[model samples]
Target: MVFYLTNLLALLAVFVILGLSFNLLMGYAGLFSIAHGAFFGLGAYTCGMLMRDAGWGFLLAVVAAFALSGVVGLILGLGSWRVTDIYLVILTLAFQVAVVGLFANLDITGGSGGLVGIPSPSVFGVELASPFRIVGLAWVLCAVVAVIVYYVVRSPYGRVLKTIREDEIAARSLGKRTASAKTGAFVLSSALAGVAGALFAVHLQFISPAEFGLGRSIEVLSLTIIGGLAAYWGPFIGAAVVVIIPQALTFLELPNSLVGALNGMAFSLLVLILLRFRPQGLLGRRSEAPVGDGGGRFAPAEGPEPAPSSAVEVRPASTATVSRDGGAPHSVTAAGAPPIEQPPPGDGATGPQGRKVRTLRCENISIAFDGLQAVSDVTLQLRPQQITGLVGPNGAGKTTLFNVLSGLLSPDEGRVLFGDDDVTNIAFDKRARRGVVRSFQDMRLFEGMSVRDNLLAALTPTAHEWIVPIGLGGGLRRPRAARADRRESADQLIDYLGLHDHGDTLARNLAYAEQKLLMIGRLLATGADCYLLDEPMSGLDQSGRDRVLRLLRDTVEAGATICLVEHSLDVVREACSSVAFLSDGCLIAEGPTEEITGDRELAAMYFGT
Candidate 1:
């Protein structure tokens, strides 16, 4: 019975490591990797092979396992660099299968048999032969790893990872190397899994290919989701329940395989239910409910408005020059559509390289869905440092056009040139890295992370400065001079945006307008070359809109370009340098705000001229 209890405790310890590792990616980073099991397997197999074949000691095996798994994860991260969401999952799935298959037939992997007799580890000469010692070892390892996990999530590098998870494009434009950030997460996650695998092998006195299978990966994912993503304790709770419950059943006369199957079914249902009702998982703070307690799957609803959608149902954005109501010739007034607020052009444009940069050129861009044209023959440009508005009736392709420019969608025809770079083929991440950034129409910032950190993370990839560097140095790089310069810059930007006091506050802690500003701050902090304001003045009252307008001006003065997509013509009239009218994905007219509104064709389309 003591042996059995020890076994259960050891498993629980291992699961704790798994939970924390998985949560770093999902809960904090907001990346959902279905190949967690593959990472786990990589650690186990690599360590097992190194020890059994190389005659290495326990510590050596652990090192080998982590290093090998991390290397593989880095490679995989690069491979999946361009893959987003659904495609990313598919790519990971393919990689998972490939990794598992390689182990299945390889001589080093012991084929289907797996490596056995992976010799139980020892500290000095005292072998980890007794169950009590194993349990103690597992707990000690868990504690050490737990400390590291705590530090990582709270560190600057961890903050950047979460930002990337929230919105990769935004992170990129903020001067963050998103690919590298993602690779960092992958490497860290894999290393933890490898370390856990090393411990598992030592605890069990064996290793098997069958042990680290896809189901195991799913189990890891389940623990993260059910345990409550976005919070530090969520993983601990999840790991304890998952590993302890299953282990207890083994001693209760149930077969080990049966325990595995039960776990599988239970976690499957767990994920499904979480998705249906509580997408945020247990400890995760909800992003939608702008004003609520920081945790769960929920959104505040003042009315019957539909839930806003973005990547992860929490975040992601775009461009353009049009409003929905076709502007009538000679009737284009300020604040043209409802909900869009017009601000005075108080500040100048934040141009390129301290130079007044202007000019946005979209050449013959087109978009279609299932052969039906959603936006076709779309050609539009917004002058530099000036607000260019896109307006037309609903479904006129204004939003679609925004997606194309922001690299969210690849146009079926033509190309997009932002001051000369052919952005036509650039991935969303790449485009963002090159100075293009967007705010979600839905406003999806990291809900659980501190509000101040949200802004900081936006600047993180670009700031490249730090208060102090970590010993591991696997995450954020912090040199004194760079760090000081960035902090000063960030502090000034935050103060200018009137969020200096709220820097330490979590995103969900803010009000609706505050959240919007937080997002805007993120863009500014990240150093967006091009600011695509998608309904920026949406959901704002007069004061909030005024504040945003003021910020826009500040951006222009800071040398940033601005493009406004809105339904309000009055707002455009007061703010835009030029306007492009879109009707059913086709550009009906383009010129100075008044000239385009005066076009006879556009006037008729908006309201029978």
Candidate 2:
């Protein structure tokens, strides 16, 4: 029983490391990586081959393997520029398969017979042997990793990573440079896995190419899925389960094929359970300040990303964990303005005669979808520094107008011009690159990332070309650039939304009001002259509604033209100078908010008496 338990724990140790590292990328970072085998195999091979062929010390060879794995990870980081989720899975799969072929084909790897005689680690020249010793060492290593990972998750760096995973677009808007963050995550995660692989090689003293392949990759993935996505200890629980289950079955004299089949069946059942029930995983809370041990009110539950223990103490009674950084509270006013959040360049709205130029003009804009005219003959002009409200009943084409103007959907017959440039045909992403941005009514925040990083990532340009030049090829030739430049902006925005205390809180953990305003901060980072906000006040309570109105007023005061599609008369009265009412895709009224507010005909259109 002792022997069986030791072996089970041993196997579980390897998978715990794999799952933790994998979570760093997949769960917390919002990536679906399948390159675990390649990294693991490379680390294992490098350690085994170097020690065996060169007669290098066991520890030295492990270091070499770890370095080699990191290099491979850096090479793989290039994929972050243009891939995600399914695409990433495919890329890593290809790499894993290719590595297996290389191990088989290469003469150095002993070509299928595998590397043998890999001596174990020695403490001052003492060979590390015995299952008991191995388990102790392995657990120690895992503990160290957990500690380091804990810091990483809670650190500002991890905050940004979560932001990228949660909403890459939002992160880009906040100036996070999603590509750079994603690449960094890949390297970090791979290095962790590489260390694990090196240890495995040391333990076995015999290496086979088969030990590292898609099967192993699948195994690590299983650990993550079984334990939990965005779960800190889910990896450990998952590893124990997969390892122990197999070992238990083996003790029962199950055939090898039957064991594999059973694992498949068990994994399938887990998938179903996760889909139907808690999709986040066991040991995983849904969202983050931290929860009590019992799991009630799992709001703002931290993921693999650790909380700032020093910055804020976990108070079970409090809904927020207040960060002591600058003594900022949970909700505070925005810090008036930043020193460098300059508006869009070149078209600064200055005319030849020194008067401000017209920033936007929508003349007779019309759009149709499937023979339904969702927007028609909508004439509007957006000037510098004004808040405009677009209101109508449900299905009145308010969102459609935003979509058309933001370049998500093209208008059938219309002229949409911005600062003397006709961008009616521009694509949505291109418009964003050129400083035209819009937020969705659905509030698509990255599900598991912290609020601070979400805002920071939103400040970066999302285009891969701009992003790629910043992180590689001498990192755009920049010098001493810190990752927290937009942090001030993000902080200010967080303060504005009363989420300064929850800056490190995951997006999924935020109250409904918080998510709505965070999206606004994301839009603010775009530095667009013309803003299109769809249903900005949809779910806000009375206080949140007032806060949003203040934001709109302040935004317009900051010299930007905002088009808000909302239903709140008080908000419209408070923030909007001009109002455009849409009915069944047609512009029925266009005037001042006060003029339209008392209009009986428009009142009849909405509130039937």
Candidate 3:
């Protein structure tokens, strides 16, 4: 009984590591990969061969396994850049099959019979010959892995992973290289799984392709989902249950065949029950609530009714100017409150220094889908420090032009120039990093995160977003000064947007107007020089629209360029200095706002006369 218990514990430790590593991809990064077991087998085989054939030390072999597995994982991660969801799953499944086939057929891996006689591991020159000794060593490694994972999930790097999982496009719009982040996570996960594989081989003194196949991958995934995803202690709890169930069933008087079937059925039933009643799992909490369901702490509220069309007056671009570095006070007021005092710019804030006045010009751009023109030969320029409005009736291709400018879609003809540099072929994230950021019509905020976190995630200093630096610069804690600066900046923006009271509130729980404010806050956090807003005030009351317009005015006064798509003529006239009108995928008119709005022919087309 003592030996049996020791062996069980050792197995549990090995699987716990696997669960922890796999969660990095499946839970935080939102990657559904079945190739985890293949990585595990690769590690096991690498370690086993190094020890058996090369007579390498256990520690050295484990290191080799980790490196080799990580290299392969890097390849897989790169491939994942082009696929997602079901397609990504299929890609990983194929990788799993290829790996297992190699392991089963390769002579170096002992073919179908499996490798054997892997030497025992030693600690401090003491061979872990007995089950008790091996189990102790296994637990020690498990503890170390647990500590690493704890820090990893709490670091800024971990936040990026969660952001990717929530909304990859939104993350990209904030200048996050999501592909790089995902790849880093995949490599880290694969390396750790390799370590677990090493432990498994050392503990058993043998390994087979059967031990690291699709069944094993599914088992690890099941344990993770059954316990919880993105929960720290979840994998531990799950591994314990998974390891104990089959062992516990072995004591039954039933036949061996019956026991195997019973174990599979029991896990399946448990998973089904969890999916039916507790979809978030035993330890995971629901990340989002249905809008207007009153499930969040700060539910949507009906504020003051829409103000009169003339309530908001157009202000000259030069008035109410504030320092972009937050060094000067702004005259814009929020909710009739006193003018907001600017805090001294922190490291996260962008100032006007080293900035060049550039114009974004789209020259004769055209695009078609299924041979139907969405945007055709439209030439438009957005000058610096001016608010340019793009207005047209529905189906006029206003959004398609926005997509082409933002690099979400490419135009079949024409080029986009920023100043003198052509940026038509740049990736969306790269374009965003170059100071061209956009908002979405649907307000794609990270609903799972708090209002403050949503803003904080937009402040970028790429160094804080990698696994190595995060692990090296004091695990479990972010750099104090940088973190404080980012928080201060985020808090200031939150206050400016009248969301100070809801900083800790989940974004999904905020009312429609508040959510709209949060989206603007996030956009501002990017510190972009050029802004492309899509229907930013669509769902807002007049008061909400006023607040947003005030912020935009302040931003423009600070030397930023703005282009917005607004359907309300009142808003366009109040906020825009210039306008570009489109009709049926063609540019109808472009001029100063008063000139365009005063044109009877254009007005007739705009109002559908």
Find the candidate with the highest lDDT and give its number: 3
Give the better candidate number (2 or 3) by TM-score. 3
Q: How do the predictions measure up, each by TM-score?
A: 0.73, 0.67, 0.89
Per-residue lDDT tens digits for candidate 3, residues 254-351, read 99989989988888888889888887777887755544555343344344443443222332221221222222223332232221233323223344
- Global lDDT of each candidate: 0.68, 0.68, 0.80
Rate residue 327 of model 2 by lDDT: 20
- Shift of residue 372 alpha carbon in model 1, Å: 7.9
Least accurate 10 contiguous residues by lDDT in model 1: 323-332
True-vs-predicted CA distance for residue 577, candidate 3, Å = 2.0
- Best-fitting candidate, measured by TM-score? 3
lDDT of 1 at 332: 10
Task: Show model 3 residue runs off by greater than 4 Å.
Answer: 287-355, 469-478
Worst 10 residues of 2 by lDDT: 320-329
lDDT for 376 (candidate 1): 77
